[model samples]
Target: MIGRRLLVAAAAAGAGWVARAAWGTVPALGASRSAIRPYAAGSPRYRDNRFHNSEPSSSLPSGSQSGLAKAFLTRGATGRPRRAIPLAAPLAPTAAGELAVTWLGHATALIEIDGRRVLTDPVWSDRVSPSAVLGPARMHPMPMALEDLPTIDAVVVSHDHYDHLDQSTVVRLARTQSTIFVVPVGVGAHLRRWGVPADRVVELDWDESTEVAGLTLTCTEARHFSGRGLARDTTLWASWVIAGPRRTVFFGGDSGYTTRFADIGRRYGPFDVTLLPVGAYDERWPDIHMNPEEAVRVHLDVDGGLLIPIHWATFNLAFHPWDEPITRLLDAAADAGVTMSVPMVGQRIDGVRPPEQKPWWQGLA
Candidate 1:
């Protein structure tokens, strides 16, 4: 009798574990590998059965497996802020023919240029992983809800990383907004699988351009990789150039510093503004993610007028202190004599006439 009862308890525990695993994967793993292969096969970067970076890169450092494991186990409140992160009440941008940017946080910004608007790498979900219940959760609440955003002309995604390309957010945007999704090659498969209308997805390779709402959107080069699971780099990664008739903006979705920025500047630059990533960086992955100083260099290489930093202050993806990226960025920009805007999350800055710099992050540190 005792043996039978123990066997029954073990079976029940196993069943419970299976149910949890299934629940965690719902609508998160995205499209299957077979679905993405058709478009992935055509690009030159998509050789070796995977995408390749222009320069060699790795997501993590070498000789650091034990160090990484120790760091993860002992993060100990060092990666977050002691005080609450400040939030700004975001204003709806409506003035036409004016250039502006409202940084929503962590590589997600709403760019209003000329008469149209473009949203970059929008991830509204609470966590950025294959499982919402088990991943890096947001340290601060989003100041503005997704439903409250003004009508967007286009939505641009830079890569297939979970943080940049969220399944739930894509589904919600499909249901709520009529905006088209302009993504790097092979990303359309995920959108289609998530029920986004096929007509609404525009897949572009590097150096490709498409006109939308009187603005020219161009996909450019970036040194990064992409994947949602064990199978890696099955899609392309890119920086973007969004040019209006009167103004141009560069969206450095997420990239390490590469010489291509100078080429991009000469080809389609002298941009009115540049939004570059300035967070979640470490020595181990220098080739994949740029540090704050490198971002300023990219801004200069692109002949950017105003530099508004992104990819920080939202999720704690790296081991650095929460405010370190922006803090170091301020010092570097001052040294470089580069004009920059460090807006509070959700704060809107007029691209033409940005306000004076304020160290809003000082107190939070």
Candidate 2:
């Protein structure tokens, strides 16, 4: 009988350890709805106990619950590449230039404009989830180490999504760099929870602008939802307008198709370059994520010069093939006569004088 009791105890202890490991990063989930309400309540979009988009949008189509469930279970190997994806070694410039962008896979990119660098949606973790054990892991390794990045003037976070705003990366940057974090309103609560000093965080609502290192970072509108846990839309999500003395750039951080792009162009049009997302799209979530063709429309709507695509080629977040996004984007851009540069992971391209569009991704898919 004593032997039986000891065995049961051992089994229970093992289960407990597994549970602990799975939930170890729960604290990194960021501030709760109550903690964020104070900062978010003032916005016009905040009502009905949450933020709302300017246009009506649903995350998934009606009656898609069961179909999506079955799809998730049956869609094997739908979003992965056929073989290994190629990567390019990022070449660090001696100094910040007029305008250039180095894509570091997914939505992370370094934008150098007028002698300053701004990092957008910096996620450097192996997996993007509250728990380290489970989530969509990186398809390819990081082309460059996080510590090797050049001095950045500011880190701009579009929203609180696990993929876009990683808690581990935030903590590391806070400990290593002295740069301030510019985020949409209510997201500062997350940074504060992650041990980033309050002074180091700046929160802004739509249309608000903040200056960092002689550049203007404006929080613009986006059609997207925000949440880190169960409660949704407690914080704001946004696109950004980065304007320098000599150049301006538009960063479309995870948004759907919206006519607001025309409005933004009228206000802050004629950008030197625009970084738009071109992946993870589905008909079910049509209003929440734009397809590649819609991305081209956004660039033209904003009167952008050179278009560089982001938000693809890292983690698989959709049901389409891995390379389909870029493939469709190239065809659409060609039809629209849109000048674009599809850089390899970690490759930097000058916005003013971009290199020829290389078909490096050809045959890799």
Candidate 3:
């Protein structure tokens, strides 16, 4: 009896230690029973008189109704059958150019715009769930490993979704390069928790603009919500505008339709390139994920010059077939005459140069 009890005690102690270690590490290995706590959504407050801060307040809540309402107004994902689409690799980018965009699968992109190289919403993990064992697994392998990425000057995060602001990816980035982390408000807490130095993290509220390495980084408004675990919207989310001496580009992290795009355009219009979300949309949650048509509308709203579609491929976050998003985008863009560039994963598309004319994704259809 004594020996048995000792063995049980030892097992309990070991379990406790494992739990502690898991909490300390990120990309949580196991699931927690409790729901994630909510953070600020967006705010109308301003700090230091720089810009208006719109936050995600617990005051408002979101549910299935949100996406359903959006889908009702417009058609849901209904178009063509999907085909097995294998991703292309190593879309090499030249160092000399006004802007070079490589879609690293899903919404992750490396943007070398106007001499400054920036990474957007990087998710280099196999799954976008709280645990590694489950959730939306990557449809294909990452075109290039994170270690292979060129020296990035800055990392711009859109929000704190498991897919968007991945903890494992953040840890690797922190280990690889001490890039400037420009993120939305309240995201600093997550980065701080993960051991990223506060100074390296620049938290911006909506409409707030900051200058890093002589480049102007502005947090524009995005019509979206946030939450990692059970916790809902506590942190704020936003699109961003990167203004360089020669040209300007906008990175729409994730959003529904809102008038803020026009506002961003009026303030910083005629962008040379606009990187916008074009997938993960459904009738259940239309407001959160912008369909290709809505993405095109927002593209025009921001007064973007050329559009580069993202947030599709890599992972099946929504129920729609993997190829539906791009097909819809192509149709909408052609109707509107909005110029677009669609590059494969790890393919560096010169947003300025005419993209290699190929429907590589057609292979999937």
Best by TM-score: 2
| Clashing pairs counted in every model | 2, 0, 22
Please, what's the RMSD in Å of model 3? 6.8
- Candidate 1 — what's its lDDT? 0.90
How would you order the candidates by TM-score, starting with the best? 2, 1, 3
Off by over 4 Å in 3: 1-84, 91-96
Any runs in candidate 1 off by more than 4 Å, and if so which?
Answer: 1-26, 95-97
Assess candidate 3 and give its lDDT.
Answer: 0.75
Q: C-alpha displacement of 137 in model 3, angstroms?
A: 0.4
**Model 2 Cα displacement at 244 (Å)?**
0.2
Q: Per-residue lDDT of 1-365 in model 2, one digit per residue for the tens?
A: 99999999999998987786578477878998888989998999899889899999898777988998888778888888888988999988879888899999999999999999999999999988888867788999999999998898999999999999999899999988999999999999999988999999999999999999999999999998988888888999999999999899999999999999899999998999999999999988999898999999999999999999999989988899889999999999999999999999989999989998788888867
lDDT of each: 0.90, 0.92, 0.75
Q: Lowest summed lDDT over 10 consecutive residues: which window, candidate 1?
A: 18-27
